[model samples]
Target: MLGEERASATRIRLLRDVGMLFESADVGWLLSERGAATSPSLDELYRGLVRALTDLAALPPCETDSGDLPASAYARVPDVAREVCDVLRVLLGRLAGAEAQAASSPASARAVVRALAAPLCVFAATHVQEQPWSSPESRSAASQLLEAAVRASGSVSVAEFLCGGTPSGEQPGALSAVLRLLRPQMTKESWKRNQATKFVFSWILTRVGRPWLADHLDHVFASSLLISDDYRTENKVLGVKCLQHIVVNVPAADLRQYNRAQVLYHALYNHLYTPEAQLVEVVLPCLLDLLSVLEKPCGSTEMTRRTNRYDQVLRLVLTHMEMEYKLALRRVYARNLAVFAHRMGVVMIRHLKRLERVIVGYLEVSDSPGEQSRLSILDVLEVVLQNTWPRVQSRLGALVRALLKLMCDVTADSGLCSPVAREELLDKATRCLLLLDRYSEGQIRA
Candidate 1:
């Protein structure tokens, strides 16, 4: 009887504290009282107020006429929501405190975090979908809550939720309720709809909803295909970026489950070299990095062949680089040629004859006084000589004379050159002289 009386007292105290914390005047005054207090006890009290309010925010939706609330009460809702988010933001840190205080194992801390997550997500989603407050602050709060839920539930469940589906073990009704709450605010302009689809793709690559993703691969691919040409550049670029993330971060076994891995590789490769596509600067480096990862030699045993799907992808990437380089030389501005050469050195080395002729053609017509253009051409020649020295040396006589004449012009007309241009010319001249002497000696020895 005494224990039962103590429990009743505790419940009554909790209810009283919740009512005080949720009062419009108290919440408004608290927001106004910032920077006024430094006492530890006051700080503790403030934290307790936040905890009570968070509990209130987490309550399952009840059928109450929010219109009946006073104007002041409605104004306080955004403030209360913001404060609750601030408190939950510190959850991971507080888990350490829970770990220290508990007599039992620390695993309960994870359960506490998990328990807080669903309620926090629902609360934030409600405010996110609220038409009255659609500002950046509200969106940020919603993103934070959803991101927290993702971290807590693992990537797969989060992906499933984003795609209007639920994980296998979760209660269907509960999931539907959450989705219904968020649906009102999740509008997508036609242009933005495809970009938003990347979140679903990312979730799948993270292994969050692998089975669902696999089952719907045709749908996803078809949607990507339907993306108009203008948007295709950005969407395809994003798609490749996501694929690289999945390829490196996800386990090989997980990636192999989707028979479309090769199809994705081909899709990325095709877009990268498509004649009209404008390649974003970052895409090329990322593609090369993915190739490097995929081409890493396997173990020496007979069962461990170096060639696999990854190798096949690397070969396609190299071929794409080669094609793009040739096309750039034939069609792109001379100024942009250097970037292609530097980026496609691995490809240039394999097709030195075609590349050498292209470089020569660019140098022949580079009679303009623009320092940037001249330096860019020289930069390509420098990379070619450095990486493909033997092949370059075989025809060094013609290339050497071309570089020497350009260097002489730059030195004689130093007034037209920037310091950067002069430095590049001097460096290329010195390297070329050294290579010419070496090649001459090798010819005599032969």
Candidate 2:
């Protein structure tokens, strides 16, 4: 009877302390968001929170047969091992948006971020590793904090929640490669869902230091397609955004010999043809960005590989144009092709010769492709001329005939198409015809 009373008394004290700590945290949070009404300093709240976590970390491991509120978890009790795990679940959950308050308390915010990150890593290292704390509760709570960081915080905050600071531009640290989280099958009860894990883990890998992505690009790319959610579109967006961020932001030195920029390029390039409009929209800029940053002085191998990728981009655009519903996306894709031709010059144009039939097919009177696709094709042709007239340009007779045929069709009195579209087609064709010297010799009046 005495033991029962003592246990009850300790539980009451724990309940009292938990209530007071939470109440103080709430007041601090309220003050942080709104002007003070006798609320405690955020710094003080953080300190109290930190002390509670450390105290809990020092608790005895929870045992299977013990009551739900184990005496071992109660500080100074038999084991006191579960104390840290208990404190983590309650505090970390409440601390969900707590990092947002740090800005209002700048004097303490940085320190608080650091305190949250470094200790949390130590805590994770204990519970998240292969041989971690024996307490299942601690492991579960640690996973909760990780996933919460991804769901609740921005990238920088998430970075601080793991690495104590945003990743620097310096060369990758020896620890940059992630092995622990590379499990083929993450124990879901012990891990975040694949999308969150992939998204957040990819972000974590990038911030580990420069060139960290060079090693894990495949896994990251695969993660984006591992779709099994209602938010699959959103997941792909985040995943592609992450890919673009690393490609554009990796330090030049880090990418020097990283031949796999080609892989990153193709990985995102293939997504451009997906039926999902939103996914296609997100992929265009990333593909463009990848093209923009395909570093110059590329070796023969990379250069040849990139040339094929460029050709593939054009081919995809041309193929998509045949489908009427895809005209809007086709316009964007062709514009990107123009940019590619401008940069790659004659080499890219040579490959495009094979697609002349397709371009003329659009201008043919039988098929009334929209003004957007027609004008965009002409725009691309204009760019090709501006880059360089193919001294060896093939199919001259056929090319001039197509131009003449398109101009005549647009100017025909039977004109069933929009006056605006006709004007655009005529204007674009006139410009394109003027670029070809054969137009003068062939009497093709644009």
Candidate 3:
């Protein structure tokens, strides 16, 4: 049996050889070293080589003799690249451990977190599909490392991260590197597209004119599958909500030049017609939010040859004004329609009597929507009537009369079985009518 002393010496000698090779900066040797360290006695040597390669990767951009080599050349080989990531999980643990000792080594702790950004990103992006699943321990370790890095670099707020931008104080090249690796990971069911939208959102959330950074910016946000293209694999609800978040974060004028942008506005347009009731609640408000941001007279010949995606944008919303199937979806339908009418202002509501009818129809006693759902629809009604009161004034006389009659009836059913639930529903309806009456000049029409 090899004594512990002998194993330690063997580990030391093998590590020296690995160090010398790294000094030469000839990456071709990493494969050979990993292959040679298979013997149980030399297990530490394999671990050493992994760390050495990670350090080599995280070093500031060095000018090696291989000028012709692509920046991504090291990762082009799948086997070698994957070993680097396996080692990366180890480094993440160390970084977390160091950061945990805040009083002892703060500067060194911060440095590890900062230097780690590039290597972690590069390893994550390399042939990710071909890589073996990182063990549970490794996954937990990586998460800890990320949290530590985020804590150390307090420059980026949590909100900014969701918008697809890095923390404020990050070095430019490192920030771009991180986003590139983050893009393809967001489409899985756990796409966290809610937070996932940030990888791209950070780029154009402000007005972007940098053509040099355009390629990176485009890859991360404008062309990402999670936006609307990768619906085949993504959870549509999560993706739509993330899309809504990005729309909120993106600056108006910066995203304006292309309001009907493919997969941006175009994707939402396509989803509206598809029978996904789940998306009805979220996508409609976002579509209207988008129109409020768009340049006027979209797609006209006089405009800058715009895709006029906004034309489809308006046409689609006006066409599908209601969702009649589920109580929850109907409530969502009312909410989205109200927000749209309110945002478009009276000029729009005054012209589209059909929209007002769609918004008001959810209140009918015969539809029988659930108690909680009915209350939610009422809340939307109050906002819609409040925001569009001037336009709705002359139009909703008979509807007001029906609401008054519903208030006086003691046996209102609307499909709710529990008496307590029915009471709650009626209470909500009464409040909605009162708010509508507030703006009715003390005499509701009819």
Query: What is the TM-score of each predicted model, taking all chains together?
Result: 0.47, 0.49, 0.55
lDDT against the true structure, each candidate: 0.48, 0.52, 0.48
Candidate 3 versus the native: TM-score?
0.55
In model 1, what are the clashing residue pairs, if there are any? 155-208, 156-208
Per-model tally of clashing residue pairs = 2, 10, 6
Q: Record all residue pairs in model 2 with backbone atoms less than 3 Å apart, i.e. clashing.
A: 56-83, 56-84, 57-84, 59-80, 59-81, 60-79, 60-80, 60-81, 60-82, 61-81
Cα lDDT tens digits, model 2, 9-124, are 66545745764566457624533532587865554566566556454434343333211233333334212323444444455445544546554543344444433543444344
- Candidate 1 Cα deviation (angstroms), residue 409: 4.7
Candidate 2 clash figure, as a count = 10
Give the per-residue Cα lDDT of candidate 3 at 128: 32
Which 10-residue window in model 3 sums to the lowest lDDT? Answer: 59-68
Q: Which consecutive 10 residues in model 2 have the weakest lDDT in total? A: 169-178
lDDT of candidate 2 at residue 98, scale 0 to 100: 52
Best-to-worst ranking by TM-score: 3, 2, 1
